[model samples]
Target: MDSISQLPDALLLGVLSLLPAKDVVATMILSKRWQFLWMFVPKLIYDDNYQNIEFERLSRFVYRSLLLHEAPVIETLHFIIRPKSNVVDIGVWTRTAVKRCVRELIIEMDCSSSSTAPVMLPRSLYSGCSILVKLKLKKVVLVDVTSPFSFPSLKELSLKSVKYPDEEFVQSLLSNCPVLESLVVKQCPNDNATIFTVKNSSLKSLVLENQDLRYNDIGAGYVIDAPSLEKFKIRDLHEDRFCVIENEMPNIVEADIDVAYGHPGKILSSITSVKHLTLCITSSKDAYPVGLAFCSLVYLEIWTLDTEWSNDLNLLMCVLRDSPNLRALKLEQLDCDGDRSCWMEPSSAPECVIWSLETLELVDYEGAEEEKKVIAFILRNANCLKKATISTESTDPNKRLEMLKELELFPRRSPNCQLAFYYSP
Candidate 1:
């Protein structure tokens, strides 16, 4: 490979830093240290095929290769602009030669018509304690914040399909990012969510996807008030004004929600300190909201379908009187009716006969016998129950597993529960 332009300029600026800075400035006549190591390669990846070229010859070769780079700390400046109109400012002279050693700034623009022009962010990046951790933006719009900004070692921040309709400029750009932890906002605007009221105790992983959030209107405050938040994910909720118990963000342990209308229900103020909860109920609920509680939920997954529920046994007896630290429970596509009476019976069978349940899964169960006596009254009252699995798709499978082995008044596993039967022909 000695023929590879006689190699070395740190191996041809690491293969022209993966090409395209106009093909690494045409590999600088392939000599003279690749014409000064392709303007001091520190990562400035740009794409969108550099937009049909010729934006004044691509702004005079990225402003003469950032003025023949004398090295000013450029370590990652990815751009993928796709603007045809909006009065083309052409990213204001290559972001003013990225003055302060730009430490990671990615902007992925895509404008289709509509022009007012005044949006050219990348100025008040990071000062004082600047380490510019990591920032990802899509369809970005942060019209320069007046400049007392800070990035005191910013952390992971991802905002996709953005649109910020001033909430004091999104809380003055998140109150100057004072040690912002992992925060991801997908599909924003209409107050482009990230509304943390004062208390920023160093946020810890919060994500709001496709949000229409309206929080901290005081009294019913908080879009986020991280007391060291712990992994929270809210996915695509068109509207119902994005409520998570009034934007409390309760010291989450881990939660993934998708809600639009659980009504005066999603008022989940205190999650009893979550422990893995995944709820993907795409609206159309008949009942799953009786002031739902998680009482320290411990692994509970419900995808929903019991005929889209009308009360799925009063939402499974409100998770047995509010999850007494539940221990693994998965119910999917449930909708039984062989006279299991569909809950509400004597207060949901004394809240599913008291719990602290341990493993109870029923997927697509339909061989109703009162849903097999509510899975044998939750294995004869979940006294630290161990197992109960019933799978059904159906196929003369021992007539629904021998009609659950001839009912036998419940006893498939008692010395601490354990009964398995899967059917899928």
Candidate 2:
């Protein structure tokens, strides 16, 4: 135990950094050296989720920690504050505490107070946030002030359950984060008349989920100009005008397009470079692998379309012709009806088949005759296929065994191939 206590103060401090903030406070009693070590920890996380009342105590904790410690450079600052109570000079005190050491700041504030309106943050708190490289804000609201906000060094940002003063404010925030690489916005709406102009070049990942906008507003004409974007996920419920559009994102490699039914062609038309694509469509004709292509596509998942197995077959034909390098295909949550005729392509259609296809996975498969036909078609064309995963609902023993028997019949021309069928409830 003597050797243990003799550990360097810095190394012991590193151990405490991994502990929760509450636990770190308790370690102050470990020894006198530890007491000073906790003060040097570069990261601080304060979670008030356990407290249902106001976050008045959180301000006190910060005040005490800052007064006692003289940390030269802080790294991460996280606070999830509960609403209602007031603390004197909180904005200024918090701002001073986060002068330079903060490279990442995550603030989750509960702003739904019963009083007049949610309390606004003081202008000084965000003055130094430009140095923050990552930020995740939830349920927080900020007002407009003469101080034009800017965060020039931010790289990754995720905003959830939060609101900006206006749509222009949102765009301004995006513009200020010049080198931002990843952005995620969910369940937030700006003023009705405001327009959010999105323009960034370094953004590589973009996710717009649950964009709640008023009717007839047609969503602030979003213009994405990120040429290096490699991944994109769009989930929208409000079917407004299907005003969705995809700007120049040629580097996209993997994407999931979840569309609302009324908006057929809402998804962007040009995703030619995507290597793996998943379409969550409700209509058979809602989308077809058309002019846009994925020559390097190695994996594809087409889910939530018509129950006709033939529809999948026809789409695969288009994909095979375009993506000659396609290998693995994953079909999940497919509800296909017994329609056998959709499997064949016209004689004039370009020859399309997965010559190198190896692995196939079908989740939630129902043993319809036409569905089996599609499965057989894959087996016949993909001469190099080594294994197939057929998963079905297990609630019914008869249907589960039925699928296993039908899929077991596919002649594994390449004995090197094996089929694994699973019945998942």
Please tell me which predicted candidate would have the highest lDDT against the true structure.
2
Query: Across residues 182-300, which tens digit of lDDT does each residue of candidate 2 receive?
Result: 99876555432234345677888988666454423554444455677888887665545343344766788888877554544435455667888887765555456457567767888
Among all windows of 10 consecutive residues in model 1, the one with the lowest summed lDDT is: 213-222
Q: How well does model 1 score by local distance difference test?
A: 0.61
**Residues 1-425, candidate 1, lDDT per residue (tens digit)?**
33876766666667766776777777678666466667777676655446577555665666677667655676776766655422234445335534636667677665553632323454544343266677787765665445576777677778776666454666666667878888776654443444433335677887766543533232222365566778877765544344443346667888776555444145344444778876665553453555556766778776653443445555555656777667787777665533333443443443324456678887877766556666776676667777878788877766776766654458533476777777755
Query: Which lDDT values do the candidates have, in the order given?
Result: 0.61, 0.66
Best by TM-score: 2
Instruction: Give me the displacement of residue 71 in model 1, in angstroms.
Output: 39
Models 1 onward score TM values of 0.29, 0.85
lDDT of 2 at 30: 77
